[model samples]
Target chain A: MADETTPRLRIAVVGTGLIGGSILLRLHEAGNDVLGWDPQPAARAAAARRRVPFNDRLDVTLKGRDVVFLCGPLRALPESLTEVARLADDGCVITDVGSTKAEIADHAARLGLADRFIPGHPMAGTEKAGLDSAIGSLYDSAPWVLCPSSTDALPGFRLLTRLIIENFGARVVPMEPRAHDAVVALSSHIPHILAGALAGAAAGSAVKQAVLALAAGSFKDGTRVAGTPSSRTADMLISNRAAVVAQLDLVRAVLDGLVASLADADDAELLRRLQVGRGLREELLDRSMLPVTRSFDLARDDQAELDFLRRLGGDGGYVTGQETDATTVTYTALATR
Target chain B: MADETTPRLRIAVVGTGLIGGSILLRLHEAGNDVLGWDPQPAARAAAARRRVPFNDRLDVTLKGRDVVFLCGPLRALPESLTEVARLADDGCVITDVGSTKAEIADHAARLGLADRFIPGHPMAGTEKAGLDSAIGSLYDSAPWVLCPSSTDALPGFRLLTRLIIENFGARVVPMEPRAHDAVVALSSHIPHILAGALAGAAAGSAVKQAVLALAAGSFKDGTRVAGTPSSRTADMLISNRAAVVAQLDLVRAVLDGLVASLADADDAELLRRLQVGRGLREELLDRSMLPVTRSFDLARDDQAELDFLRRLGGDGGYVTGQETDATTVTYTALATR
Candidate 1:
């Protein structure tokens, strides 16, 4: 494996699905020499078609690679990493794009690659999945969570983290593996459950036609992730069951409160519950979490920027950057509250 | 009140809020003489500022109007319509923009105004509300549900319906008041509950910061409606309590199944649940329940139109008008799965 002196990193993407393929494509665009491997013949062929430096043999792909990213599904990651450990060169940093981190980290630790394995979860996805949905810029401006098995002081982990943040243009954030799992359970997994349940309820209803007819922007956007491939969604849910269940319990409590308010015709209580949700959303927006960056020089205040700011729908937007004489206005349309 | 011979209809909007103000603005732009009334001094002043022909006195606004629209909250609609009934000129149709229809229809019947009351709910809203959020094109291509107490033969009701469909450009669908309530409970109420609960759960979580940071597009869209003012949402929920509760039960059952699937680590069950939701969403898109009209001539084969049809997200789109060289293509991006 090349040392820090090497200018271009050698990267191996272990699966050419949505997350894996997108990562490879993006890293390749960022000047990394990326090799890809997917067990499925069609998937590998598709990656090859996209000119993703495909290698049929996983062992061959791993050899001499600076880092091997096990970008397989949650259920398959443990075994995939095991194979990576067996085949990959020593001193090479290992990472993953798994949804849940604790189990993956434990598996890496048991395989004697704990310190080298930085469990990463890019907080980015689309309703679509697989190679067909892979885009080179998917991870740009996305939050990439890294839960290092050891400390970030580890050279290999730090180098890999820097590469992801700098090359991929992702905002790298550090957290404990358990904390990552728990937070995503509330933010990602439970929302999927909510969407799936809504779609299921509507699908199962006698008024299915009407429900479909009336489903508007809110319903569609809210339930968009429910359309993700079933296998992938299931893997994430089951692998992260404890956290998701904890979030579900909270969801049920909130729902029960709403139901009680409805039953009692307590408008005030219902209003309070709704207000609490709205206030939380506003707080989320003001916190500047998940911002969409918009940059423009103050000398030429673009009408598009103004319109974007004015029409900034959802929670609202967070406007940052000061007005120096030659000020470049950089704003992120964050948790638009 | 003017008859069919009148060049422009004189319309009185009883509430100068989002729905009412938008309707007034749009109708005024469509050449209707639109007058607005609101008990709130601020709302009245705002409407007047927008040149909404604000009349603080309801009777003054309704004196000679062809139609009186009681555009207020579900809770206030009964009283608003009662006031409209007392003031509106003889033979003038009365309608409402309340989310729930059954209770309002009953109230109208009790007040001896059912024959002239066409209970309506335009299935269009944004998280923003009040006079400030009012826009002229808000109802364009949106579904305007009408639960007419009397049949279409009623002159006043038919005239108002025609004006809404032809002038406001909203798709007018006739439905029974109870049926409308039942359908919307599934389509609108349950989705709001899902959004609010998700936002509330995320907000109440220990990892609110991380949840906000990691929140993606689906989560944002899924929880968008939760940003709506608490009072308004509570009113909608309470007025449609029975239907909302029924829908909530369905939601609970679906959620329980998903929970069980996760607990058992039953990948197949989880996949089936996700697929069911996906399939329902697909069916919704295919049905073209919510549609926007787009037209193009066949003589010029529009690449954009073709791309729109092929790349039509969700369940796909409906294509109409054959290639007779003189034919025009029309499509709607509805129920995007």
Candidate 2:
């Protein structure tokens, strides 16, 4: 998958879970020098059995790498990134695949690795878990989020984004760390709360048997994440409190609006509220409506370029491709509001 | 709207459809002086051949009846009841075989027929339909639900319950009209509300394109029921207003609790709440978890029996069997607190 523009990237992927293993496999298949690591020997052995390029010593595996992806668990990422920053060459572009970004961005800043440490969250997963489910195409067409702290980190961001666009088939989205959290709070965290609440509310009803019989596909889908171990879901929800809480207030408003409409016997208002969501949902699901792409040359004023990237992310756009020299970046998106 | 007639009853069945024809056939066989009317000659002629007493004029058919069964389609029930109330004598016990109770109950109240009009739903059907399928044994052992509006309607409700229990071979369960609506609201209306809201929230997120790609099973499933036509969903929710509003309040509280826990960094409380819902959902899903049931006597205290009947329907319980004399009602239910 490596085109003529791609350099032979020396990449190390820490943590051989789905994201790490997939990143390792994809880079290795792209004719790169790639190595994988896992804190657990059993996990490393499992990947090794798959004929993956795996090493037992994480520090040695991370050494001399041009690109190091810290794909460890959220709790382990900060320490692991510190280790990767310490071992890998000063030229190494470090990134990660964690759901949230702000806390880690703060840690990277305090460690003075802003230029080398590019925070990322590649939006990819499968129902299956662990290394066996890892595939080379995991990041294909997926949105890989990047939170660039300042103008100094532009080169590292460009290097990793270009490599991904060229070989891994990822769509790069450069967003503010907080914005990423807000978006996920609406999309992921709120749904979990709604799911548990719905299940809980129904369970307490006098007509629970009726609810059980009637709650079919919708109830199941809504509550699917509540099935995740409670402590894990709580950790994820609590980890990004500000975004999750702000978005939850918005949700409470939406619900309160519905309740008021019902209380007033306002069928017209009820229909209006219900229709707003329906229209938006239809837009989200509308595959036929191909989004337009806009591009800006990085050679322009640096502030202008950064502003464009931020606007692109704000517009729900992602960088799809770029000039080999990294002068211009083109992204697919709706027009900025 | 009507006074009580003596024990011996004059019964009439309107619409001559599957349910109407069956009621006519069964009541005529039990020697209740029954009459059947169908606006369509073909349907009535067909029922006539099946030995169902037919009257060409609906006014004459309904003139002297002590009980009238408005077994028309949902869309036609309101108009049919209006016509029946116009022609029937004041003492007539007006009832109907309709699925959802709230809308028609509201209409009956508007028509000042709340005392006479008791909404009913019989959980019995076959692959076969129409007058030809009208067997005297059709309602045998079937659960017939009666939504009693008030104690003024209790006499009418009692008369109909006795008739259905004796001649129709039915088991009677009395529930308040709004309570029945609430029961169904928790089961059906609330799911639709949740689905639409979840979809709407995601579509409005700032990084919605990322959300579109990343909000997987939970997002899709949560909004799955929202695919139902908007006007249709709105109408269903609005019709069952009180119950849905109350239940949605409970849902909002649950969501608020999760938000507070996340805000306070109270992982333990968050886990406790989430685990409660998870346990409830699993219990709902567990086929092996047979719930305990307890029944009370209907003859012991008539006043208490009314309250118990309300509780039974509220508890998602149903009348399964009864003493043929209607002295003791046997219901399937979870133990009441």
Candidate 3:
């Protein structure tokens, strides 16, 4: 909600890459006074070229800002927050947009800024990076995860939550720092790592060239996240080491079970596993819970069937005995022979 | 090449789905007199709605047709070809577009139509199917694989090759039937099976709902093919059983090596494997061997760094840094970092 008499809240955004720039752009579009800071000169120039407001001096940028959003590498957040804590107003809200939370929260406590910090991670990103890739609507309808520590500053958390909901049009999902790290480790980090690994393996083989030649839309989409900077991915794994390791263990366990099924040549079990996986994917797609777009093919086919039903009069029903599910849709039309 | 004086060929296309419909549409666009045949009334209606010329009478559709293209289920191809052989002109150029070739080739030989048939497969598909999903440019720049038998229908083969190139703009690749099956088994069938199995496993789990909710773009992309009919997949596996078994053995070996490396915590070997896979993907991507829409996200940071050299007024050069491979990328980035 905007009050004409009250001045707009000023927000400082560090790291003007995709995530940071996107957050800045959204806040700006929402009529908030937003300024950006980035250590990389190229990134800073890119942000400025894109008309994203920025201040070169971090101290000046932090001065009197109602909220400072740390949107950089997970490892960089601790020291950056420490620097801002020393310069920012006592009542200013501090939040982060990193992938992991436990370590950052710990660092906030160590920096004695825990009470003023609200650790938040938006579950949104594109394969591209930098301000050039930023879009104002990037976070719309995405989940903005808020990892609240036991000693978290309630007022800061509330303000950050409101910004996420009202300004970015994102739903606020509160999660424990460790739990959030673990869930993401399973859902995001490990997948990226595995994709990179799979791509690497395929790359090293004699068939590598042909494999790529044959690769269709699926492989490209599957490996999209693997294209991120190795440096950033490195920091992610290192900063969230324990949780990542834990997720890796889970992945290995799953893989091991799969390997066993293959070893036993249990076709029935294999088929069951396949059906279950397809079901899971469909359920998520139907619910719009996943961040990816469901294939238009699926939507079109569903609509086509619905259209067929509508064309048939209310009293006209065709019983073509066919089982329909996410993985398969069969139609057997009854006709007078 | 089109010659204005050349008599127009009468072509019969016996199916109208993603691959078949695409071939028919493209051929029709190239000025061939195309007649479509499908048992399903809805499929026939959809083809007609798309203005794909069709004859409802199968006998009329096949009679006097210069060439007949059987584009339907792998299992249905043999019977359909047999029926076409009985009705079509004695020396009609016949080709069937199915993923697997050896069995169909055998069927043709057994049916005494080997001289009239040129076994072929088009290595391209969209996630969508049906006549409405067809696109004229679907086969552009993709491989159209042909498996020529000893009977050597040279005239038919050449005519078919010219037609595919002229109409679909595909690169005709000639391979032995066995080789064609093997290559696709590794590249297509096995991947679909894996996707289905993975989807099933995840769906069957206690965390099924949550797991699906967090399924990122990768899982969705990786599992897109899982939605195809299980019977279709089973037929593929059975027809190409030997090749699929061989590829699975290779995959299993690789997976085993990875498991051992993980179990031993042999960082060097693990890094080596990771490098191999990454290099495979990058090399494929860089060469444009894959039919992927070029996205900046897939570009390696190293490539970005190389591109950045243009700003320094130096000739752009590839970096031969100490860690050029995927293993180095993974270990240095994920584990050791």
Docking class of 1: acceptable
Q: Evaluate candidate 3 and give its CAPRI docking class based on DockQ.
A: incorrect
TM-score of chain A of each: 0.80, 0.90, 0.79
lDDT of 3: 0.64
- Model 2 DockQ class: acceptable
Q: For model 2 chain A, where is the 10-residue window of minimal lDDT?
A: A328-337
Interface alpha-carbon RMSD, every candidate: 5.5, 3.1, 10.1
DockQ, computed on Cα atoms, for candidate 2: 0.32
RMSD of every candidate to native, in Å, equals 11.7, 8.4, 15.9
What candidate 1 gets wrong by more than 4 Å, as runs, is A1-8, A40-52, A130-133, A151-153, A288-337, B1-8, B40-57, B151-153, B288-337
Residue B115 error for model 1, in Å? 0.7
Q: Give Cα distance to truth, residue B270, candidate 1, Å.
A: 2.7
DockQ of candidate 1, scored on C-alphas against the true complex (2 decimals): 0.29
**lDDT for each candidate structure:** 0.73, 0.74, 0.64
- DockQ values of all predictions: 0.29, 0.32, 0.14
Q: How far is candidate 1 from the true structure (C-alpha RMSD, Å)?
A: 11.7
In every candidate, what fraction of the native interface contacts is reproduced? 0.63, 0.57, 0.26
Kindly give the stretch of ten consecutive residues in candidate 3 chain B with the minimal lDDT sum: B328-337
Candidates arranged by DockQ, highest first? 2, 1, 3
Tens-place lDDT per residue, model 3, A64-125, is 98888888767678888888888999988888988888988888888777778888878778
